[model samples]
Target chain A: MSLSPLAIVLLAVTLLLGVGFYGLLVARNLIKLIVVLQILAKAAMLAFVAAGYGQEHMGLAQSMVAMVIVADTVVAVIALALAVQVRRHYGTLDVRKLTTLRG
Target chain B: MALWTSSLHPFLWLIVIPVLASPVVYLAGRLAGAALARWLALIALIVTCAPCVLAAQELAANGAATFTLGLVQLQFDGLSLLLAGLALGLGTSVTLFSNAYMRGETGEEKYYAALLAMIGVMVGLGCANDLFNLWVWFEAMAVSSYMLVAFYRDQPASLEAGVKYLVQSAAGSVLVLLGIAAVFGATGQLSLASIADSVRQAGATQATSAGLLAAGALMTVGFGVKAALVPLHTWLPDAHSQAPSGISAMLSGVVIEAGLIALLRAVSALLGEGDAVARFGQLLLLFAALNMMLGNLLALKQTQVKRMLAFSSLSHMGYMLLGFGVAAYTGQSAAAQGGMFHMLSHGLMKGLAFLAAGALLYTLYVAKGAHGPLMVNDLNGAARRYPLAALALGVAVLGLAGLPPLVGFMSKWQIFVGGFQAGDTLVALLVIFAALNSVLSLAYYAPLVNAMYRREPSHAVRLGAAMPPTMIVPLVVMSILVIALGVWPTLIAWLTEPAGQALLAGW
Candidate 1:
């Protein structure tokens, strides 16, 4: 069966989310985690843009997705800055070793 | 026409004030020393608070109002009002406290500036009405939070917690975004109300139903990471316990609530009137129960004060979940009311606890003249030295443990009664367990009080003249409000009722 454009976009988004989440769960490096999160954000935006397909009205979905992209970029930048600090201080990005906060 | 013109759109001011003030706070940092930076942050927050208070008043008086931002709409409803008020109130108090709290610390400017920006983002998230808009503000809040977490750049643990928090939060945002995308794909709408309407009309097709359920689950887990719910809550104790005390207060007190509100909004829209949503609610109930049990049980074993509070926060999140579970399962008016009430009350109470803790830490730092690695035992016999700070701590803990004549008990009562009224026997049992957990919480809380009051004086327990009034005043104010709300819960109920009504209005 042929899929609609929306369906294809939806499937791609599903893949992206799945991959991103898998990477998030399995990845131990802070930088790689950030990259996966960015990918995940893009997937969500793609799904959003695709949802507005076939509508004759204004590009509401497009603009909203654009806004989300901008927000994600900002978050990524800040996360990277924090990660840089972590690397400098901790000398490594492995999450398991950062357990100085147990009660 | 003049009368109407004189009163600007309440929603407009709510959004604009924070957006406008963020840059000013950032710019002000460059012009002056830490003193000016603190004042600027405080003024910016005060300005931000004005609009939120007005919007809340308008919500109380005229009901929920919607203002369009392009195709997306921004609404100032009772829920918005309640969340915004808590965010702003805590934001203002914390700004004041941090002003003095961060004095003499290295890199103070960046700390205050980032904190001010975070407050703006949090207030915006609280006020945002549409799904897409909520996501934008939520990300904004996350970014700022990551910065604050890593503010102490020299501390390895602080940096580590910041990285962990960022990675986890970023992943969660992605999941939420994908869920939003899926809902948009199915419904062709980004507005929460429109999405709910389309989902309701589409009925339960295998693909659509599955897609929505998957999306909902993804969003729930995504947000669960931020809410510090169990299983996904691993980051919280590390993040909250390692950050600078002022930043810790903001993180525990207000930042996590942003995620919780987002999840609640999404769940309410998805499950407003559907069996699928109801099933989803059941899943949430199970998660809530597990979170409640694990969070408190874990806290009992912690030796660190900050880490203990972190675990207690996890338990509190479970209590908030109890409110959400009842509301979702039965959608009873009282249950919904209880959920919103708990959100408001928890925000204030938790914010107070963290700030008071920060004040105690500050006093300890001044007395010891030490720069780093302060331990819990360092706080032995603190009460005789800093009676006022100890009083603040006592009130905050008592309130947190849900003792009567304090706000915590009032909020818990609403949630417990609502849970029982909804006939969720398991949840009611969980609520009872939660109440007992509060009593057990006293075990942990009482020590700080007892250590301060009864233990032999340690050198670190002595007071210093350097403890600033700015920090002291906010803690005292919050402590007083905790008691005031307990004696007169109607004040909070009045605010929460309209917000709950607004949440359920379209449904």
Candidate 2:
């Protein structure tokens, strides 16, 4: 049997979340983590739209996505800026190398 | 009366003034230099506090006041006033301390701007009446703080801590965003009051629906990370210890509590009045137990002074959560009032502790021309040279250890009384556990005190410089308030009672 549109959208959402979370868990490169965050943010955006559509407030959902997009962009920019600093200071981009603050 | 007077929309002005003026403050610093910018930042915070005080007065005269701007709603109640006052008070003090502590540090202008932006958004978060707006404010506060955490970009530890904090906190905020979306989907509403009404009207079936339950879980875990809930607090020690001393004070003092208040506000609005409140209360008590045990036990192992204080912050959060759980379970405002009071007193105690530690470190830097983390051993005979800072540190440590005649003891007593008043076996047991944890904290705290007062001067302290007036002034003021409030606990009843009622009003 073929899935309905909502089912297909939900399947996509779950798949994105699983992949994003898996990436976050396994990714060691700083840039890779940033990419993973974007993926997870995309999953959240899709969930918001699906939620809005389910509640018949597509306008509100779309507006929320817009705001999230803006906020997520800022987060990504800052994370990248921080990554550059991390690389410059430590001469590495591996997350495992970030242990100087460990007690 | 002028239509545009701050009294008319005092809470609104509290949010607007600092945010709009932050960039201006930065520009002023860039043009005129750090000194002028420092004054502007202090002035901006004080100006922001004017509206906060006005909001408190309006709240006192008229009970809770709500100001609406389209979909956004701002509420000024006892709870909002408490949070706003804590933010502005700590914000101003930290700025003052930074004037002395952050001297010779690079990027002073950006630091002031980020600090102002942080205080602005935290006030906004405290007063937000709409759930989505609350999350937005939370995100803004987190973003600004991330910058502050990474302020020393040239330092590897600072950068590492900043990146880790950013990644983890960003992940948490995304989870919160998803939870908010799920909540909106379930309720078709966004404001806390509207959502509360919708959930209450829908009855048990809709309230217990998978979607809503998932939303609740998501928000809990999301806010839990920021709140330093156990198993999710791995990032706190590093971030708190590595950041500049003033921001450390802000983080340990108010930022984490802000997360808990957001959790309480969001969850209370979503659960409305039901068995759900009690069930959530049970969950909070479980986290409370874990946080206290783990926080204090780990703190006992810390050799670094700020790191130990960081872990102590985790345990203090546990005590506050104890107050919250009892309040939620018993449906009594007294326990919640205790929680709010603990937030106030803990802010003073922890802020003092961190700032005093910072003062000692600053002295060491100035005298020895050495810089890095300050180990507990570095405090040897510190009291002789820096008597005021050491005294302030003593007050902070004893107060946090729950010694009598200090605000910490009074606040903890209120929480314990709140638990006993519940008369529930489980909550009472939890309170006892929390009490034991307070004593456990002293095992670590006493050493720092001993190192400062009893041991001979370490190399760092022998040639340390005197602390400036800007830093000393805040320390003295906070110490006086801590002792004054402890002596007359009734003085804060005005703040605590209404704050407790505000928490319960959502129900």
Candidate 3:
């Protein structure tokens, strides 16, 4: 059976989101976790484009994606800097070990 | 009578002024010093507020007006002005206080920059006429505040908190983007008016209702993460406790409230009294009840004064959500008004409390030349040494606990009355629980007040070390407004009613 473009895009989103969330939940390395988060963001960005592909909405969707790209990049840059700081402070990039602030 | 010459609109200026001026404030701080940066940011915020004040005047004199530029649309109505006033007004106060609180601290120029930038972004979110623009402004606020949270990045705790805040909020942003994409997909509209129109047109259609429900759920979760609602609030304690007190004030006072405003705007605009909207509202009521119950219960266990305040902030958000949830569920304008009013007053009182927390820590640093996590016990007998700081803290605590003669009591009272007026027994019961939660909150806050006045000197506090006038001035100003708004409830009602009407008009 041939699938619609919406179905294809949604299937891809589910796959990417499933993987990203799995990594976010299971990844021990902070850097890898951030990378997974980026994948999740990419999925959303992709959805924005796919939702607007058919009609006269492509340009607006593309511009929105571009803006979201800039925002995601800023988050990445800061996340990387924070990762470095975390590594320096905790002596590891391990999420399991980064538990200093507790009740 | 003529504040607008066609080119000038307060909604545009409210967002534009701070955003364009943030880098200049940073540069000024760099050139002259943190002190100058502080004054410049204060001036920038006050200047930014001029448009809102003018807009309010114009609205009073003429009537409600709408302005649009490209993708951005804003209402120069009472709601936007009230939120803008709180943001810029508190922004000015917080900036003034930070200069003295962060005296001689490194990277302060950047702090002023990020702080000022956040004010602009939040103001943008306030007046943002479209859901897409709202998400963009909200994300900008999140990113700037991430930097502010890690202002002390060298400290491991601060960096950790910053990272946690960034990661969680970034995820939430992605969800918000997805929700917007879904909204645009289903309705083919992004503007608030258009979205509302489309949803109204497609009322009761299975495909349309499904998409709206999904969008509502996704957006609610997204904004809930940012608003520090019960389940998604793990990041807030760390972020608030680690950020310098000046930043903490903004984070607790306005940022979360901004998230609430955006959520309410989206729900009001897009969901438009559909079955889906009512379902969403029910879910929100459930979340609000949980937020109020568990938020206060959890806050009781936090020892770090700032973290405790952070949890208290979470609990207050629950109360605000209770009002909003009731409004959405019952479509009551009064409930919406109460929710918005709660947002404004909470911003004022919590800003005061967090600023006082900063000053107490600063006083400790002054006496001992160092500081660490500020505990409630750390503030013991501080009244003897720093009477003003202790008194400020005491007043903030009482106000937060819903003591009368303060803005907090008036807002809380209205929130419940609005809930009961929703004419739903469950909502009325929830409001009663919320009222009891207020009393429950006083349990934790009371000891802190007593500690300030009744306890002996546990930690050494300086008797005379040249108190920082910059910090004290802002505290005094905020305290006066807190009481001023309380005594003159009509002033706030004048603002809240029109805003409530704007949202109610959607229904």
Candidate 4:
């Protein structure tokens, strides 16, 4: 009745993805949204490593994880910078107020 | 199958030159002058075209070019070369137009640098042969674009659009990465060719392998955001309308199409064993139909000129998707060729439309002393003052509406013909539906044209600045190509035929 290590890892990854998506759906603050994105990246990175482990290609998986980390960080940095600008210009951190460009 | 061969590894040259030189352009702006940096950026884009042309030549002679540069794999077939050439061509025009449009604007260095970087990665995306490599290039392009989209940080609209775009696009890329993970897990390979071979050898079907189907669905929705497919296209209208006009042209013209191509590549790799491709094509067609209807319907209510164009871009994406869907469904090269040609046509036509609109906006700001974005009403009798801009805009809108004398019509015709050639009842009906949608788009396009030439001068157009030659030249060039290509599409057969064949022939 015991699950394998791979199953355990995959379950964790799925849980992370679900939580991250839930945060995205509910969170309004830009910073929290960015945190959610980071959470999602963790899931993706974990999945990559687990997939590599499943295939016995740990080296490839690790290198892919490294690249994802760098790319994910760049996204965070940009998102945070934009968030700062958003707060300054709009005078609020809520995304609901960004309705200037209405259809 | 070999038609030609070249030892020159132009793919490396294509990617490395602009990417490596982008910072140099930024430095020159800081140390030398914005003018120097601007011209340098233009020169850098022009120089990058050399490798593209050489690769095109190689593709012409050899039918395809695949080579490994260090650890990264690259190729120059019809499909890759067409995309590279389109990006470079659009990049050159945008850079040239910005010289006049962005004059005296702050942060000119960062603008040019990010623009060049985006172009570089777009070229890389075209040439990428590995799935992970494609993802990296896509992320690089998306990152550079987020910077460009928020270029006017003081403007709240720009900042909002930038953040929205950043979040949606970031989420989409993460989805794509997860899909790649699932794909690698299923096939144990990352190169597209190997993945396809493995999937085929295993005879994987939707019912047989839930993992691969899940991967395909995830990638579709992931890439769909960037491609601006309906339901995932919320960020596009805002981002395209708020960014500077040159960037707007790039975003509308080539960037979204690049997303579609990336999706096409990924999906093509998954197109083996059972009804996988057919199911994917059915999904594409559903999106295509929605994109056409909703895009045109919403566009009818927009007061802003750029917003209208942005919405219209979604509809155009629909047409191109229809072509690809038909191609995928029938396993024929005809519809895909039609789709490829439509990409080329739409890239030129829409780029010209946005640029022409941009010229009018620039003049409105400079001469008429306007403070905000241009509205369609602002174009009332614009032809009397800015004749060339008005004419260019007219040609662009009409072409986009698929009038018979323009390149848009020819491409749409090709797609319809492709659909009919499929001999599938539903696909044929979809072709009819698409034709009706094309006519529906003119509901707005025609009015814009009428406002330009048929109405009394609006206050905004009464005394606008003389249209700059830098802006006029690109519109003239693109307009000419649109007409000439429509009249003689055979001229581009070398590009379109090979590209469509490459997509159908698979990795």
Candidate 5:
């Protein structure tokens, strides 16, 4: 079946979400987790843009996606900074061992 | 044309000030210490807030104002005005408190910069009428807050909290993006007003209903995490407790409210069909009820003052959710009005509570000259030691516990009445249960009050030097507002009514 643009976009989003979730759930390292999150955030923005693709005006989706990207970049920088701190303080980036508070 | 012109006037400034202020704060940080940063942030907030008040007045006079950026049209109505006001007010108070609370602390420049950036983002979020724009502002808030949370890079707990908040918030943002995509795919529109019109035009078929339900569920989950509703609220207490007290106040106060507003916008836009409305409202009620029960019950068990306040913040979000849910079902104007009032009131009360806690911690640190780690028990005779700081805490807690003649009681009364008016007896009962929870909250809140007033200071409970004017001024101002609003709720209701009406106008 020849996929519509919308279907292609949706499929790509689903795949990104799957990969991101898998990485987030399975990754042991903080940096990997941050990477997965960034991927996930980007995928969502792509989907939002795809949603507005067929519309006559694309400014709304474009503006939103642009904003999300900016936000994602900011978050990634902060997360990396925090990760660096975590490494210095705990001597490792493993999620399981960093249990100061009981969940 | 008039609607278009009026809406653009105030909202344009609302969006501009923060984008401008972000750099101003960064520049100002170089010239002065924490004091200059605080004043700069306050001035930015005041300027931002003025536009909101003007927007409220304009909306009241002109009905609803619309501003279009390209094809996306944004509305400035009573509801947006109310939220903008709350964000500005809470943002200002937190800035003031941070000046004193964070004095002598390293990284003052970076802290104030992030704080200002976050406030600006929150203002944008409040005024945003477009869903896509709203999403951007939401992400902006998440990013800035993450930096603030992890400001004390030396502390493992702070780093942990920062990491956790970022991961969770990123997940939520992704969900929101996907939901936005789904919404666009179904209706081929990005503006909330346009989407609602399209949904109505299409007539709520099974396919459309399912699409909307899926999108709504995703958006709700995403926003719910930020609002810190139960089950999805795991990251909140740690993050709130670990951040610098000023950031904590803003996180619990303004940030959560922004999330709640986003949820409100999503629900209001999509709940056009009767069946859709009913189904979504039911889901919301379920979450709200759980949030109320679990949040307060969990709070009751926390030994740390800040952690308790964080949990209580979650519980209050539950109350707002309940109000929003009721408004969804009955379309009762009052329910929507109550929801706005609850958001504003809870923001102020929680902001005050967190700031007061911060002041106490600062005082303790100063007097004792020991900074390894502090616990709630360290405040045995805090009232005697720091009378003004203790008084601030007392007033904040009393207000939070819904004591009459305090702001908290007034907001609770509005929400309860809204629940009852909507004829949601179960929710009304839950509101009553929330009331009981507030009374029970006294168990935790009263102790701090008693420790401050009644308890004699042991040798170990050292009295700190007097709190600086910067911290004391905001606390006193907030405490006075709580009492003033409590006695006269009309001050809030007048604004909230117009805000609600604006939301319902297109409906």
Candidate 6:
């Protein structure tokens, strides 16, 4: 059976979420993890806008998604700053070896 | 309808002062001096705190005060007021303590910038009635805090901790937004009040509805990470321990509680019916119980003082969660009231504890060149060296361990008594488990307390001089407040009652 437009959008969203989570779980590098997180944030934005689609007050969803993108950008800037700092401090961006503080 | 007249009258100053103060503190700190910057922080905090204290007193005496922002509404009710007061009051105390604690430290301007901005966003987080506005404030707080945590960028551990914080919380923020998206989609509403109205109209059956449960689970996990609720709590021990102790005070004191309140808002407001609440509350109680037991267990194993305090912070979050769970399960105002009181107690007591520990670290830094592990063993005869801090630490840990005649005990008493029914065996057993966890926490707390007085001083501890008076001032004030509030538990109850009632009535 052919998927409806909503179904296709949802499928795309699901694939994006899966890819993002997979990258988060499997990525060995800090930069990879940050990129994966950005992708996940993107999926969330897309999902939010899609959730608002075909409904009354679609503008609300659009506005919210725009806000989410702004927030995601803020987080990205921080993440990149942190990455530069981490690379400066640790000499590498591999998260697996970044185990300085232990319980 | 004017912007300053009605909608933002009370909170406008509370919000604007700190947000505005961040840049002012940064600029003045660099141009004038650290002394002036510190004075600015204290003054700014006082300016922000005035409205909160007045609002809290007014809320206590006259019930809730409402400030409507067009379609949005901000209520100066008990919970928001109490948490807001905790944020601002502790913001002042932390700034004062930082005056000494952060002395001669590099990047002082940037340090004050993050600290002031974090305080403003936290206060705004407390008053936000619109879900999206609340989320934005929460994210803003997180961003500012990432800077605060990693302020010592020269240190590898600080950056590591900040990186871990950002990586984890990004996912947490996404989850929170996802939950909000689901709720908006389900109800076509973004305002908390409107969402609750939609949920109430949907009735008990929606408790099991796929979309609602997803919303509940997502939001709970989202905020739970920030609140340091169990498995999601790994970032906290590192973040709190690695950050400067003054910043640690704000993190443990205000941020976690605000996270819980935001989570509670999402859960309680969006899941307004009986069945949904019961199920969600059960889940929260499970998380609460786990957080208490496991967090205390973890604390018992920590050798480092700051790290131990971090674990204990997690345990206290469990107590806060227990109170929130009660409100969730039973729609009981008593539990939320207790939770608010718990928030107040945890904020003040933990704030004091971290500052006192920072005093020891500060002394070590001053005496020697760099601070060491801050292990419990490092506190050999700290009492004789830094008497005020040691005394403050003694009182703080006692309060944290939930001893009688301390604020911790008062909050725990309210949580257990208000949440538990008289005759239910399982519930009573669970309450006992919670109480036993508090007692077990003394396993770690007692050593820290005893290390202050019972042991002979190490050469290093004896060499260090006393903490500066500015640092001591906030510690003394907080320790006294913990003791005073404990004695007059009625005072906290009165302040917190309206917060709970407002939440329940709003729901």
Candidate that would win on lDDT: 4
Candidate 1 per-residue lDDT, tens place, B82-136, comes to: 7677777888888888876777777676777777677766766866767778888
User: lDDT by residue for model 2 over B175-200, one digit each (tens)?
Assistant: 88888888887777889888888787
Q: TM-score of chain B, per candidate?
A: 0.94, 0.97, 0.95, 0.96, 0.94, 0.95
Cα lDDT tens digits for candidate 4, B422-479: 9999999999999999898999999999999965899878767788899999989998
Candidate achieving higher DockQ, 3 or 4: 4
True C-alpha contacts between chains kept, each model in order? 0.86, 0.77, 0.59, 0.76, 0.79, 0.73
Model 3 over residues B1-507: C-alpha lDDT tens digits?
Answer: 233455766568887888988999889878887778877887888787667778778877877767766665766666666677778888888888887777677888888888888988887787777888889889999989988898886788888898889888988888888888888777778898889887777654787667777788788888888988778888998998899998899889998888877877886676766565666678778888888888788778877889889989988998888877887788877788888788888998999999988888877763355658888887778888778887888788788888989888998888888889988898899999999999999889988888777547774453324458888998887888888888887777767887777666766
DockQ (model 4, Cα): 0.84
- Share of native interface contacts present in candidate 5: 0.79
Clashing pairs in 4: B3-B61, B4-B61, B4-B62
lDDT: the better of candidates 5 and 6 = 6
Q: Which model, 2 or 5, shows the larger lDDT?
A: 2
Q: Which stretches of candidate 6 lie over 4 Å from their true place?
A: B1-8, B60-62, B202-208, B366-368
Candidate 6, DockQ score (0 to 1) = 0.78
lDDT for position B101 in model 5: 70
lDDT of each: 0.75, 0.87, 0.82, 0.89, 0.78, 0.82
- How many angstroms is residue B5 displaced in model 4 relative to the true structure, after the best TM-score fit? 19
lDDT of 5 by residue, A1-103 (tens): 9998877987888899999989988998999999999889878887877777855446767766787787778778878878888999989999777678543
Residue-level lDDT of model 5, residues B331-397, one tens digit each, is 7677777777878888888899899888877776633454433456766787776777778788888
DockQ of candidate 3 is: 0.71
DockQ versus reference, model 5: 0.67
Better of 1 and 3 by TM-score: 3
